[model samples]
Target: MVSRILVPAARTAAAARSGLTMRSIVRGFQTSNVVRQEAATVVAPVKKPVGAFRGGLFGFLLGATASGAGMYYYVIDEYRVSNELLTEDIYALQTAVQRIEGYVRTLEEKVHSKKK
Candidate 1:
């Protein structure tokens, strides 16, 4: 019976020494002089959003520049492909015309030989 009583008493003494008692916990939450003074005389600044393009000045210019560059690149690439196709077509037409001319010359020579 004495050992059981001493065990709990020892635990309570150890808790008090380690500052785990109820009185210490209550004192920790009590306001001090510095905290009270700072709270009484504090002012917070009002935050505002930065309005660099809320008036639509810089945003409009940037968008226009990007659009113009995209259009220029697209036109240049389109014309490059079109020029290549046109060159190939012209070469084919020239070869066909030369073959037709040769056939006409052969027919003319045959007619002269027959007349002779």
Candidate 2:
């Protein structure tokens, strides 16, 4: 009695396993067919010409030229301002040196008079 019951249970399990395997195989084939159809229906291939790339490069260079011109003017203006400051500093240093020379001369004359 136990053997009879066990046999039917084993057969049922084997049938279920085969059904699952068949479903998986069918699903795989269907997926592959759909992918093939999509690949065929998609747009055609086209090559881009070298001129398009050259034009892009030219535009980039033009932009860089304009930007560089603006930067050049800014640098020139800064240099002019810096040159003015340097000139002012030089004049101040000359004035200070002259004042120091006069003070040295006065001290020397005082020393000479005392000695005489």
TM-score of every prediction relative to native = 0.56, 0.53
Per-residue lDDT of candidate 1, residues 13-64 (tens digit): 7768887864433323478899999998887887887587774877888899
Tell me how candidate 1 scores on lDDT.
0.81
Report, for all candidates in order, the number of backbone clashes. 0, 0
lDDT of each: 0.81, 0.80
Task: Judging by TM-score against the true structure, name the best candidate.
Answer: 1
Q: For residues 1-116, could you state the per-residue lDDT of candidate 2 as single tens digits? A: 44435445666567577874323332232457888999989987787766978999999999999999999999999999999999999999999999999999999999999999
CA RMSD per model (angstroms): 7.9, 9.6
Q: In angstroms, how far off is 64's CA in candidate 2?
A: 1.4
